[model samples]
Structures are given as structure tokens and as C-alpha cells.
Target: MDRIAILKLNGFLLVTIQVEMHDQLVLRLQDDLTQMLERTRASGVLIDISGLDIVDSFIGRSLAQIAAIARVMNAATVLVGMKPAVAITMVELGMSLAGVRTAVNVDKGMVLLHEAAGLEAR
Candidate 1:
């Protein structure tokens, strides 16, 4: 079962991570989200990580990879709701998260995705 709930909303994939994800769970999420995006043909992906208080290099790298994969599939990726500590940790760990767009919150993320897709915001 997917620990992450991947919901499709307005031609985009909404993923919320509200738990402390183990390594295996995170990997599974990567695979599952990839499949879900392909199956749904979403215009973008918005990952909500406000619930997570920590982010390690492995997790940061995985997030970057997911964004890269989405871009290859012609879908935009917007990471949202990252905590301040998480941001500090990622910077300290030298995780640039290239190719991954970020927003302060889900609303802004949706706006970015909508703009990228050339759709009017709802």
C-alpha cells in the first residue's frame, strides 16, 4: 500500500506526505507516484511536505529525482510546504534540488502549476 495519498485534482497530481517516511516507503512513493503520473497524464505534481520536520540527503536526492522524472514525462513538479528546518538542512547538506520548483504553500503551488499548464486558476 502507498503511504502517500496521491490524488488527482484538476489535471494535476496532489501528493501529501503526512507521516515519517522510512527509506523503503519513500522509494515506493517514488515508484508509485511515477506510475500514477504516467497513468493520469497530469499537467503537474504538487507535493505537500509541511508535515515533515526533517529532510536528509537521501530524501532530498529522491525529491530531485522525482522532479527530474516528471520533467522528462512533460509534467511540472512543485514542492510545497517545506519547513524552515528542512530548508536549512537541505542547504547544509548541499542539496540544490535542481529542476524542482518550490512554493510557500499548496495554493501557490497550484497557481504555479496552473500557470505552467496555461490554465486559469480555479
Candidate 2:
């Protein structure tokens, strides 16, 4: 099975979604992230979706689910690097992406995570 490249940095998991995700791939990612979170005991998840031009409903739901599951595991999820058009489209599509925090970019997301976790940003 193909796996998404998830990087661990300063106790946070960084997931940069660079490709169009199908349902199976998204499911696999959710599973992999959950397991990784448990193993690493990470405090936060920062998902960078800048490469994705559009987030269809499936992907949006997957992101929401990932955030919710991460929260249940005591980890916060912050979505970042969304394109302006993508954000507009998501809203037009009526996907609120509830329960998920967001940042304008990866850098901002990192800062937000650090602040939320009470960790000093480097």
C-alpha cells in the first residue's frame, strides 16, 4: 500500500498533501496518522494543503475526521496552506470543516501549534 509522507518535527506531525487524494488513499492516511500519533504521542498535527487546488467533499470530510480523531487522542489539528479559491469553493460547497483549526500557511500553523501546546517557538 502506498503511504503519504508524514514528517515529525519538534513533536508535531506535518502532513503536506501534495497530490489528489482518492477515497482509499485518504482512508489509509487517516489510519496511518492515527497510528503514528499514538506511537509518537505528538501534541499537534499540521496539515499543509497548498498543493491541492481544490478540496472536494470527500477530502474535506477526511480532513474533518482526521482532526476530530486527533482531538480524541489529545492532539490538536491545524489545517494550513489553503488556496484562496479552494477556501471559497469549500464554503460554496457548504463544507464547514467543523472542529478543525486553520492557518494561512505552514509557518503560521507551526506558531499556532506551538502556542496551543505551550511550547516556545524556535
Candidate 3:
């Protein structure tokens, strides 16, 4: 029952998925993330998936669901550290990850969030 921890930083929620996850873990993450968003009142979410070697359809849809939920909560979602192969595979698998924003790395992700939230450049 290892769950992904959501860290709140400078008005944003940061989650780094370090291992391949099962369906239950993914569902729990989505629930926890939305709850965190509401409790913390964070303006954005930065998801770092650099350690993940693959992005299966289930995981991709979960990401999109998280992003969608965050959007309705008035929080932006930025997915960073997606490998080229994973991105290609995601597309090939028909997961467009629509409505989800992405960045090259966490630093750029933060910038994207700040810009979207209209915060002063950090």
C-alpha cells in the first residue's frame, strides 16, 4: 500500500512517481492528489515522472484525470520529465494526455505554473 506522497511547495503540489505502479496505486494517487489540492489550496501541480520507464494507458489516463480534477479545482497541472520513448509510446497507445501541460524538467515546470497562475517570476 505504498502511496505517492504529495509535497506542497510555494503554492503548488509536487509529486514524483519513482516506481512502476499498479491500478490501485494510480487510483489512490488521483484521490490523494485532489484531496491535497483542496486542503492546500495550491494553484498548481507539478508531476515528475522522470523515473518511470514506461507510460501505459492506465497511467496515462490517470495523469489526465488528475490534471482534469486539478483544473476544476482551479489548479494547473504540469507533467515533467517524460522521456521521448515514453511520450512516443503514449501517443501510439492513443493517450493524447489532452488538457495536460508539460515541461522538460521541474524547474521549467515551476516556471510554467508561475506563468499560468500569474505569479511573479521566481
Candidate 4:
């Protein structure tokens, strides 16, 4: 499938973007994530982007939007595993990605997610 998979894990949702997302995929992710959040009532979200080597302005903005929506739905979002080049590109493109917290790896991302959800990370 072209869609990304979002796994529910320990009161949080894990979304690992393993593809170069296009517009439709990004939009669908937002919709699907929203439904998942409501259905699962997750406390936090952890999105891994290590597989992504490039990120355009639209994708960056979409990530921020998804995090915002999650926050509104009572779920915090932590983005993880961003490539250095992708981070630089986003800054150069003037994308702040505000409201979305970030971590260096999935392990750290889970810690942040758990912390935000007021759960003790093991």
C-alpha cells in the first residue's frame, strides 16, 4: 500500500514514514492519524523519518500540521530520526515546524513520548 503504517504502542502511536511521501499520502496520513487518535485515544505520537532522505516545504509543513492536529486531539507528537540534510533544507526553506518536538532516534523519541504522556519510560 502507498499509505504509511501507524502502530499503536503502549498508549502511544508509532508512525514510521518509510517512503518519500507525496501530497496525497501526506493528506491521507493526517486523516488516518486523526481517526486513529480518536479511536485509540492515544496520549502521544512518535513519527520516525529515518527512511526519508529528502523533505520539501510541503512535506515539512504537513508534518507540522499533523502535529498540531494531534495536539488539539489531546495527543502530543514527537518527530524522530530526521536526516541532517533534511533538517538543513527545512531551515533554509524557512520551515520552523513549530509545535512538533523532535528526537534523534526512535529510542529517544519513545522516551519523550512517554514523558509527555506522564508515563515513566523504562
Give per-model CA RMSD. Answer: 1.0, 1.0, 0.7, 0.8
| Candidate 4 TM-score over all chains jointly | 0.97
State in Å the error of residue 75, model 3. Answer: 0.3
lDDT of 4 by residue, 1-122 (tens): 47899999888999999888999999999999999999999999999999999999999999999999999999999999999999999999999878889999999999998889888998
1 or 3, greater by lDDT: 3
Give the runs in model 4 whose Cα sits over 4 Å from its true position: none
Each prediction's TM-score versus the true structure? 0.96, 0.95, 0.97, 0.97
lDDT of 2 by residue, 1-122 (tens): 77789889989999988887888989999999999999999999999998889789999989999999999998889999999999999999999877788999888999889987899977
lDDT of 4 at 122: 81
Over the full model, what C-alpha lDDT does candidate 3 score relative to the true structure? 0.93
Clashing pairs in model 1, backbone N/Cα/C closer than 3 A:
none
Point out the higher-scoring one by TM-score: 2 or 3: 3
lDDT tens per residue, model 1, 19-121: 9777888899899999998899998999999989988888899999999999999899999999999999999998998988899999999999998899998
Candidate 1: global Cα-lDDT?
0.92
Off by over 4 Å in 3: none
